[model samples]
Target: MGAAVGAIVIGASAGALDALSVILPALPEGFSLPVIVVVHIPPDKRSVLAELFQAKCRVPVREAEDKEPIVGGTVYFAPPDYHLLVEADKHLSLSSDEPVLFSRPSIDVLFESAADAYGPALIAIVLTGANHDGAKGMRAVVDAGGSGIVQSPEGAFATAMPEAAIAMCPTASVLSLSAIAAYLQEV
Candidate 1:
């Protein structure tokens, strides 16, 4: 066994729901890392992502609340219109801050903050998306000595985000969606 991973952060955009359906259901109930997800979604609409994933995933899944503590064996989703941040104390904080790259709940915000909080204990993953939103964030994770994974562009529904991340963080592992799921299960 290796040192326990403290947290996992995932970012996705276009075609995210379908991708999540595959990955989320594969996570085992005993997973020991706090999993945080940021998927591009319409900010104005109420999100049911938590409810949907909870139904399929054996592990507990819910929308992240402001000031909540991050817990292992749980999956937390950034709310539609707020930036989700992780503190050094391992508590979550929500910010109504301006959107980044036109996304309110930017993947960069969550990934960067989690990387800062968890340092080498963090694992960051970038999935399919139309833009390069998560590229710099993944770089931050790697710079902080955290590991990074990017879905292979060929395996993504939208390749731009993964491609950008791979370009920016050349050492990051490039895995297919199924491979990523398997890796998570093993973790």
Candidate 2:
């Protein structure tokens, strides 16, 4: 039942709470893979996602800090208004780069960088969202020989993101939100 993956990356926008609430809590205690998340959010509003999820999750959950080393068995959500990236050495980095797909903390930036850093040892999951931000990132993961999973468009609260990812990488596994939670737990 081991997923040979070194790290996991997830991206979402609209309806992200429902998806994350399901997925994060199901990770068994001491699960070893590091999870990095990007959820489109307001540029000015404070992000409480880390605090919100930490209470509900078994694993350590926090906001990604610039230059921090990425740790296994933890979940990190990108801070609002910044792009989160994985350095080749596997350290977490923050960028004030221009937003992608009109969203700061763009999913594409995180996915693309993580794809390069972890390559075949990575898994990228695209969940519910309202835009196409994650499509290019999913393709990058696939091209880098990493695994890609997309939430089924039909079951997603906002289908555009999942549909776009599926269209971009037709070979990715398409599953329901609950199924996605189960899948992550098994990894």
44-149 per-residue lDDT for model 2 (tens digits)? 9899999999999999999999999999999999999999999999999999988888999999999999999998889999999999998999899989989999
Question: Each model's number of backbone clashes?
Answer: 0, 0
Displacement of residue 178 (Cα, Å) in model 2 is 1.3
What TM-score does prediction 1 earn? 0.98
Best model per lDDT: 2
TM-score of each: 0.98, 0.97
lDDT minimum window of 10 residues, candidate 1: 1-10
* Candidate 1 to native Cα RMSD, angstroms: 1.2
- Expressed as tens digits, the lDDT of each residue in 97-155 for candidate 1 is 99999998999999999889998899999999999999999999999989999998997
Query: Which residue runs of candidate 2 sit more than 4 Å off their true CA positions?
Result: 1-3
